[model samples]
Target: MKQNIGRCEFSQFPNLSKTICQEDDISNYVQHLNDLSSDFETRFEDVLTMVIPQLIINPYGDIEETDVILQAELIGISTN
Candidate 1:
């Protein structure tokens, strides 16, 4: 997937070290977060594709029909 997005060359970080650690720092952080979000979205799409066959065969795997319950059962995440 990273290769699909092209090679991530080790470029130098921008002049973020000079910025005051406040709201402005958020812009830089948000860029990194966006990259991470994109990566996760790509990976999740792959996983969803792999799981679709099981979902079609299993009665309990209807995430498409019931997102709330399905997410709770499949995602095992802790907001805290």
Candidate 2:
């Protein structure tokens, strides 16, 4: 989406974008999106360090999840 922006000219821009926010220039809108993406990456930098359990992602996966506490947590998550 970020890569394909402005590569092709739209006959009429999407009405949702226009209705949501006021941007007179397409270039500015593109720039805004770029900034937003950058901001999101910056804010979620800590998420990169997070070691997510494979069992949480795929319960039926052939993963040797040995931690009992983690298994309990997974059960709690599933129950919720």
Candidate 3:
């Protein structure tokens, strides 16, 4: 199985003062949020594809191994 983790960072302007600051730009902020959500979805799909197969093998020979594969298949449908 392959393990890959990615991190993203963004600057936040949480301390904007009304007297010294301008009003927030709604259009730009919405675009940024959409972009971030898309990036996260892409990264999650990549990791899920790698991890699900290894989890199905059940090296310890547990009976619940079958259930894991079923659940992974269901998750794959939604992710794809």
Candidate 4:
């Protein structure tokens, strides 16, 4: 996305003419993405605090033994 945005002219930016911000296209786009990421992090703070299972993120990586309940959840994931 960044590479594609970098290839575009500032004049070609979406809503570039409408936005009141004084920043350049690249800076504005970066700030927009940063804001989106922050919003997602705030929205999913509970999921973040849940300590996502490592194997769910990386199937090939080593993982410590988890409780039976979590292991059941992992099995459910693997089955799908």
Indicate which candidate wins on TM-score. 2
Tell me the TM-score of each prediction against the true structure: 0.34, 0.52, 0.31, 0.39
Candidate 4 per-residue lDDT over residues 1-80, each given as its tens digit: 54445445446567753555533856787778778989999999998889776666786343246665666666666678
lDDT per residue as tens, model 3, 1-80: 00101111122333432224222544455567778878988989877667555445653343354476566665665467
Residue-wise lDDT of candidate 1 within 6-43, one digit each (tens)?
22322343453343445454555566767998898898
Decreasing TM-score order of the candidates? 2, 4, 1, 3
Q: Is candidate 3 or candidate 4 better by lDDT?
A: 4
| 1-80 per-residue lDDT for model 2 (tens digits) | 64445443433557544443433455676888899989988999899778887775787554246476666666666577
TM-score of 2: 0.52
lDDT of 4: 0.65
- Give the TM-score (vs. native) of candidate 3: 0.31
What is the lDDT for 5 in model 1? 22
Per-residue error at 19 for model 1, in Å?
16
> How displaced is residue 17 in candidate 2, in Å?
11
Clash pairs (backbone) in predicted model 1:
none
Model 3: weakest 10-residue lDDT segment is: 1-10
CA lDDT of each prediction against the hidden true structure: 0.53, 0.63, 0.47, 0.65
Clashes of each: 0, 0, 0, 0
